[model samples]
Target: MEFSPRTAIVTGSDSGIGRATAVALAEAGMDVGITWHSDRAGAEHTAEQVRAAGRKAAIRQLDTTVIPGCAAVIDELAEELGGLDVFVNNAGAGDGVGFLELDHTIWARTMDINLNGAFACIQAAARRMVAAGNGGRIIAVTSVHETQPKVHAAAYVSAKHGLGGLIKTIALELAPHGITANSVAPGAISTPMSGQDGDDPEPTLYPGIPLGRSGRATEIAAVIAFLALPASSYVTGASWAADGGMLQMGPVGSAHLDSSNWRQG
Candidate 1:
């Protein structure tokens, strides 16, 4: 519980929520290791922001589907940063194909990126934390789909759900080492993954969300940053939903539905 983290690593920090989280952790006085999949420039941008916040920033290329190689990237970054006190598993992707049309290749890729890769990478980080004998924090960036089902996103939903469960199991297994594991589930956010710029989510009017708008990447970052801090030491094995009340729409949506057309999605 007495945590003074000096270094942190965030996967998929090249953009969106990952980028925001790296910056937030840096602002919290922790050196940050940032990883990118395809966008080296975006990763560099995040590093710059980290440096601007007066924290050391290390950049690495991470392809989560690359199995042991991706796990190696996490270790490499931790080494470069001197040590790892916080690890955020934020690298993930979703295939929007319907279940009827989903293929094994796509399903496997989704599982590898969002679940399998996370398992490997988080395990690697946890090993370092255990060996260092420093109480650490492990946070996963899951989605609201981790709890709710999406119409055309069976693979994605399942993978997020798996990641969420993995965090809970980790919380139980790592507690003896003083390592707390948790997850943050976000609703529709304005990010590249959501086909919108990762800027202002306030102007985007979304009637489905109770807040009447999409969420900003920074909003979710704030929650993740809190989990990585000593203030959250007592919290573990928990999933925090940063959605704009989107998860609470099931009953409301059903009550207001004009017809059965909603079943098509």
Candidate 2:
């Protein structure tokens, strides 16, 4: 419940949602472990932000696509931080190839990073939590495509859908151990991934989103921080849609459209 001095590991924390979540957890009085795949500088910057918040920061280079090594980093970071109370599986990759052009290699690569890697890290983190005899929190940063289909992102959509199910299963299995697993689904966030930069920009009004704009990384992080609290103990196996009400419309919102132009690049 009280997260003061608790430690958390956030995978792919060099930027985007992971970075925001790490900083937020630090601000909430938890020491944080930050991992990066390519951007060591970004990871260091994130660590700096965490330290600036007056929390301990551990930095590591983690390529989630690596098998045993991916999970091993979780253990290493936990040991370095003394222990772990929270794990955020935020590392993922995707491509825009159409389903018809989707090959086995691309599909495998996407699954390897987005689904398999996440599973490895979650297993490692949960094992540590159980072994320590302390309840913990497991959060995954999924996407709106987890529930909705996109035009040319078959691999990404499939992986996110699998991740959603995986979190639910983990929640069920870990409940007895006082560990909770859940996911935060973001949509059109203003991050580098979505081709946005700098401060949280004003969202452009869109017909599909009730909120009329994209979301901010900090907005999603706020939800993750809440889920990590002792107050959210009962909120396991849930997928919180932080998508500005985008999912609320689904196909019905666009079914009446007369043009295929919406799918154009």
Model 2 residue runs over 4 Å out of place are: 1-5, 199-202, 256-258
Q: Using TM-score, give the best candidate's number.
A: 1
Runs in model 1 deviating more than 4 A are 198-203, 259-265
What are the clashing pairs of model 1?
A: none
lDDT of 2: 0.88
Q: List, residue by residue over 146-252, the lDDT tens digit for candidate 2.
A: 89888788888999999999999989999888899999999888887877765355555666678888888899999999999888878999999998888878577
Angstrom error at residue 38, model 2: 0.8
Per-residue lDDT tens digits for candidate 1, residues 1-265, read 4789999999999999999999999999999999999999999999999999999999999888889797789889999999999999999998888899999999999999999999999999999999999899999999999999988899999999999999999899999999999999999888888887643344468887899988899999999999999999899999999999999999987798788875566
Model 1: how far is 261 from its true place, Å?
5.4
- Model 2's number of clashes is 1
